[model samples]
Target: MARILALDYGVKRTGIAVTDEMQIIASGLATVATKELLIYLEGYFKSENVELVLIGEPRQMDNTASESEVYIQEFLKKFSEKFPQMQMKRVDERFTSKMAFQSMIDSGMSKKKRKDKALVDEISATIILQSYLYK
Candidate 1:
């Protein structure tokens, strides 16, 4: 079976996650610069069979679109244009960053390690994928 991929998009960097072939477990894959995301996805898609791409949709506490949504919207347009055959969906991403941070704390990660934004991004992506899987 083709895997399901998830992304936690940011202006500077993006986190990526993927499920197993059975689509049962979500795992953090990588953190890539925003500018390199398309290239990275292109290379990954060429090697792996990804049936769907889940992108984290940032929203404010009141459910309005977040400021970051502008960047995400732009990315989505280019993403669709670059990979028209790829299926994409958006998943609500409220509190994901906070959750990721708490997860790191609960996991006993070092303070220095916990401060790594890339690691947080990757964990956030995993959380996003897991949320989708559970849904």
Candidate 2:
């Protein structure tokens, strides 16, 4: 079975996560600059047997689309064009960042470490993957 990759797409950095072939236990993969994502993904797809891509969707508190949806929609369109054969899905990402921060605190990470945006992105990606798996 092929693995599943998840993305927590941000304006600057894009968080990445992946699950095993069985699609369990999502783990943080890396955080890359948004501008470099496509190039990086091309290499990744060439190397790994990834079957699906899950992008974090920013939704409103009332379960409606947010302003970020516009950006995400465009990104997904381009992403689909670039990886036409790859399957893509969207997962709601309402509080993944907040949850990532709280998880860092619970894990006893130092304030300096917790402040690393990359770490937050990594956790966010993991959250997205986990959500996808449960769904």
Candidate maximizing TM-score: 1
The lDDT values for all models are 0.98, 0.92
lDDT of 2 by residue, 43-67 (tens): 9999999999999988888999988
Model 2, C-alpha of 101: deviation from truth (Å): 0.5
lDDT of 2 at 101: 96
Once fitted onto the true fold, the runs of candidate 1 whose alpha carbons sit more than 4 angstroms away are none
| Native RMSD of candidate 1 (Å) | 0.4
Backbone clashes in candidate 1 total 0
Cα lDDT tens digits, model 1, 5-123, are: 99999999999999999999999999999999999999999999999999999999899999999999999999999999999999999999999999999999999999999999999
Number of the top lDDT candidate: 1
Q: Which residue pairs does candidate 2 place in steric collision? A: none
